[model samples]
Target: MKNQSPIIEVAELFTISENPNLRIFDGRTGPNAKEEYLKKHLENSVFVDLNSDLAEIDNPKNGGRHPLPKFEDFIKTLGSLGIDKDSHVVIYDDKNGANAAARFWWMLRAVGQTNVQVLNGGLQFAENQNYPLSSGEDSYPETDYISGHQDWQLPQIWMDDVKLATQDSGSVIVDVRESQRYDGITELIDLIAGHIPNAKNFPFIDNLDDDGLFKSPELLKNLYSELFENYDQNKITFHCGSGVTACHSLLALDYAGFDIPNLYVGSWSEWSRNEV
Candidate 1:
């Protein structure tokens, strides 16, 4: 495995919790996320809200339901969490790394913070491994985080870019939603079911094993290699229902020693609303 792999095992995380530079974030998302955090979480793990901390929920149509937050606001958020450029951030969510945990990791990396990793197997896996859990909230002393970039460093495309890609044979748009959702057989979350035209279905769940943990790096490399054949990694775009789970695929790609592709942050939610 690569030394800079974006994943860290639960045992490794437990051992590093005592390090002064270590910062753990609980990235659980959804309606009852806050309440769940108040109930139980990893010791010393500060809760990071997906909607507020990680996203700007001004309008769903404008930038999907959970669009990336403003750059300055995110920098402040990092500061509030006592995270600087050198901080070692380890984020985890209840739903393995497939939920907001991966999104948080992506957001941190977008800001050029290199010392971040998503907890492999997430909170559930930690519990299975008998890792200790603590109840109630936690807080950390604020620090200064002076970000250099006004925007994300990683690749991301909007709906217009995706539309143009549909007509371009060189670009490959990947829809990371489930098969049922991709085939228009079911439209539960979004208003519509079918995927964007010319987009290939490579469900994000496929990146995980039956144990709900991500597959081995070698396995992921081979799997994505087969899926992407001759497609240029740079020309590839990844998206999920609203761009949350899409990060899971992106993380898997990075862990597999592949280049990180572009993300359509608005994803299906924004796409379904548009006439295109």
Candidate 2:
């Protein structure tokens, strides 16, 4: 089957609600994410917890707060979610796909799942569009999802690599946290403040518009093309707090038809703890 766009609109999802291969997920994160999901979510959507499902959390100094789970564990997770190779998966979160939604999308794409997509504009947009919603959990029969790749196919960089990239004039390291957090003015999440030595600040929220929807592909392409004009795609890396929001920018890049760049999953959480 031909791959679909990484972004899907509410109207299209509504039309395809009855597709037997469709599997919708609510990928929200926060202290009360599950509670919020249990209260209401897209109809027939199963809830996926960020800390438990998408990540293998341990010491922050080790691999940041939300490191990717082991590949085998993630495969089992996919199976438990009823996501087979052919499943048309759609994910959303309340944060306009900036939270765990994009992380889930990236993981699926990394595993060579071409039919997965993130719901454009996320839950609020769906609710505003009057897409059907349901309270409580929805269940589905599990499938043993067979992966095509032995590991993540997408580019990922560790702290040591990122450290080198920061000093390489040919490379660009982008920090996707808010400017204040990047500037060392304020930090509510990670223990430390400020950004990597030479990492450029490009908050992930900039990927959205006034309606909280992603900007036009042409516009995004133009915007990123200008910013990254001097560097090769392979030389660019993106990171954010705990490695979650960085995928939002990566998603934007993919939506803009650019090659997905390297992801620094340790991000600020691990960097701050390890570095000065």
Candidate 3:
């Protein structure tokens, strides 16, 4: 079943905590993410490592830092997490939904799993709301995740396609990295600074309010509709430093009731390495 929205509030999550088909995931990243989760996490939420579970990392020059895993491997990963096709999956990260949580949500949606959502405001909001938390690891009985789609169902673009789109006046490429990185001011992660040619800078943070939660759907619709009014959704592409945080904006667009756009998984990371 498709969720009413891609973003789920902590209050609503409380109501569905007891749903037999519900599965919660802690999709935090960083060197100490597992340690942090072991210290404290949403009750019964299984930890999903970004590097090992969500991405198939290799040479960044080829596939970026966080390329989507193979479909068969991903299905096995879902099963290992005890997530079946019918599971109502809720994912969260400490950095709001801009981290691996949104990536996981995007991956699930791409695989035709519609009952998944990112917890709005992420772990911080849930903690502030006094949602139940548990220490140490949590486990669930593994199941075979029967998936009908053998490939990713959502739209995605390769580096060559993005190059062609850049030449098209009607197409738009959105860079969701911070303004500093986009503007060549300072780049802490990638080797090169500055954004792709003709790409527009729209930091992923803009999708959130002062409270760190997503802006209302109506507000988001108005904001993005104007920016994307002239182009067809298929002609738009969203990307970030390594193709992870880009999903944050994609999730926002989905919440705003717009069709999801193309994700350039081999984003700036791969582009910078391959290009001069």
Candidate 4:
């Protein structure tokens, strides 16, 4: 399959809405996500639940609130979604691309799929552009997706590795959460308020422009370069609450044409609980 750009515009999507190879997915999550999706979502877009489909969520205390689904299970999930190696997947969520949309993109990329992209500016942007929306569910033919690997090809670190990195001068743990949460001032999601020890806060919002679209590649490249100048790419690790939004920055790094760094998928959610 040919590689597509990591970002896709609303106009571009509208033009190819009927492409046989195009598979659209909505990755919105929350208590009301299903209800909202059923009420109205992009026409012909299949809804993928983050809590059940993308993550295992067996033990939040250990794996964080949204741990990645097992490799085999994920492959099966993709099969159910009609995804194959040749499919061109477009994903989006309500929170621009900062939510599970980027995570889905990262997951597809990790599995070596080349034809996946996140909808730039997400659902809101599409709505503003007058893209058609549909109520209720949609369906597509299923596929027989097969996994050739046992693990994610992407760089990821566990809590133990993060602990080692905290003490290692050559390594840096980067926290991509907001400043208040990082400072132990205000936290609404994870149980603890403080961030991981020795991890530097670099909020993921900085990846976007004032309009909520990602900034220019050059600007993102320079910004991340300065943040990671002292450490090698392999030594640098990125994380956020429950391992979700961390993919937002990872997506930015890849879009900025830099080598993707280690993702601490457990992130603050697992770290805070285990450390406490």
Candidate 5:
């Protein structure tokens, strides 16, 4: 699959609303998910649940609330969705690709299916553009995807990277989580209340204003470019709990035309499970 960078503007999607190979995934999730999806969504988009699709079964006390799912089972799930190595997948979620879209994007990339991308503004933007939404379920013939053993990629840094960055004083570790979570004021998902050892708190929410619209790309560039002025973009690693919301930062970087960095997939949630 020759996957060109597939970041598309809201206007661009209209050009290919009828491609046979195109598969759009509705990645909206959480308590509001099923209801929101039932109300409205992109026409012909398939639903991929977060608790079901993006997460693995786990004991309640485990570090990960929704851990990564098993491979064979995940493959079976994808196959039932009519997805395969040859498919050009477009995934999106209303929560800025944070909640579940990135999860599907990661799954596609993990399987060597490079022709996958997260919709920039997600379903809300699509609807705002007056794009059509359908109440009917998306139905397509099932695909029997012949699985290839993929070179498992871990383009992630661990606490080690954090420690090294702290000691050596080279690149910065930016936490893309909320400020409350960063300040040790709230312990939503982890044992420890504080952030990574020496990381800076640059919540992804800061990238947006009150309207839920992202700030101007130039403004974002001016803001973050100064914030990360001392470091090369590749040397930086974007992360959030279980490596999900961090994609918002990755998206932010892309919006700024900065070099995309490695993702620490297992963020603080995974880190909290480890013993020093």
Candidate 6:
């Protein structure tokens, strides 16, 4: 297949209804994503459960909840999805690139797959665009998904480093949870809040609007001016409830053409469990 393809446009992804290269994956799982997707989804898109296929569970002793899958396991999942190394992966969810699409994107980058992108604003945007929808189980021929070299490029910083860097003037951390969650007003996930002490709060929702589509680059530029225009990109780290939504922020930053930084995948979920 010499012909290459980018992610499907919001219009085509829904309107055309079929694209082989544009693999629209339902990266929406939070105990309900699978059921909801089964009920309905963008036509021709495939479903991938985050919990089962994407995670390698960890023991309570190891402190990793939903640990990353082993290399072999990852290869298997890609194979089952009928994706090859060069597959142009486009993952989306009901939430604003939340759910687990960002995680799916991160996992793709972690393995050196560079063509992955999050469906900014996600499923709601598709519907808002008046894209067609279908509800049914679709199957595909099983392809021999070959494993390639592990090209781990995405970085992961630990809580210990983040703690020490709080005093480092040049370092910054961005908490991607909702504003109330960041302010400790809403304690949904972690017992402690106020966002890693001094990390800036930019809820993932800001990346999109009421319609669930991303704002224009100019608007995004002004919104992220303080963070992207002025600071060192590598000095930044992102975190959310469970390390999933944080990637949303990172993806937005990348879209804005700023330096993409490491993600603290342990996030608050794993961080709160630590002594720090």
Tens-place lDDT digits, model 5, residues 164-244? 665656677778999898888998777777777777888888776665656677888898888888886656777777667
228 Cα displacement, candidate 4 (Å): 1.2
How well is each residue in 1-276 modelled by candidate 2, as lDDT tens digits? 435689999999988999999999999888988898899999999999899999999999999999999999999999999999889999999999998999999999999899989999999999999999999999778999999789999999999998898779999999999999999999999998999989999899989999999999999998898889889888999999999999999999999988899999999999999986
TM-score for candidate 1, residues paired by index: 0.97
Question: Residue 198: error of model 4 in Å?
Answer: 1.1
Model 3 Cα lDDT, one tens digit per residue, 113-192? 98999999999999999999999999778999988989999999999998998899999999999999999999899899
RMSD of 5: 3.4
Model 3 / residue 73 / CA error / Å: 0.4
- What is the TM-score of each predicted model, taking all chains together? 0.97, 0.98, 0.98, 0.97, 0.81, 0.86
Weakest 10 consecutive residues, lDDT, candidate 2? Answer: 1-10
lDDT of 1 by residue, 1-276 (tens): 343889999989878878999999999988999899999998889999988899988777888878888888999999998899878999999988998999999999999898899999999899888888898998788999977888899999999899999999998999999999999999888777798999999999999999998999999999999888888877899999888999999999999999899999999899888844
Please report how far candidate 3 places residue 181 from its true position, in Å. Answer: 0.3
CA RMSD, predictions in order: 1.5, 1.1, 1.1, 1.4, 3.4, 3.4
Question: In candidate 3, which residue ranges exceed 4 Å CA deviation?
Answer: 1-3
- Candidate 6: residue 24 Cα off by (Å): 1.7
Candidate 5 regions exceeding 4 Å error are 1-6, 57-63, 70-73, 146-149, 159-168, 189-192, 209-224, 232-235, 254-259, 273-276
lDDT of 3: 0.94
Model 3 poorest 10 in a row by lDDT: 1-10
Summed over model 2, clashes come to 0
| Candidate 3 colliding pairs | none
Query: What's the TM for model 5?
Result: 0.81
Q: In angstroms, how far off is 210's CA in candidate 3?
A: 0.2
lDDT of each: 0.91, 0.93, 0.94, 0.90, 0.72, 0.71
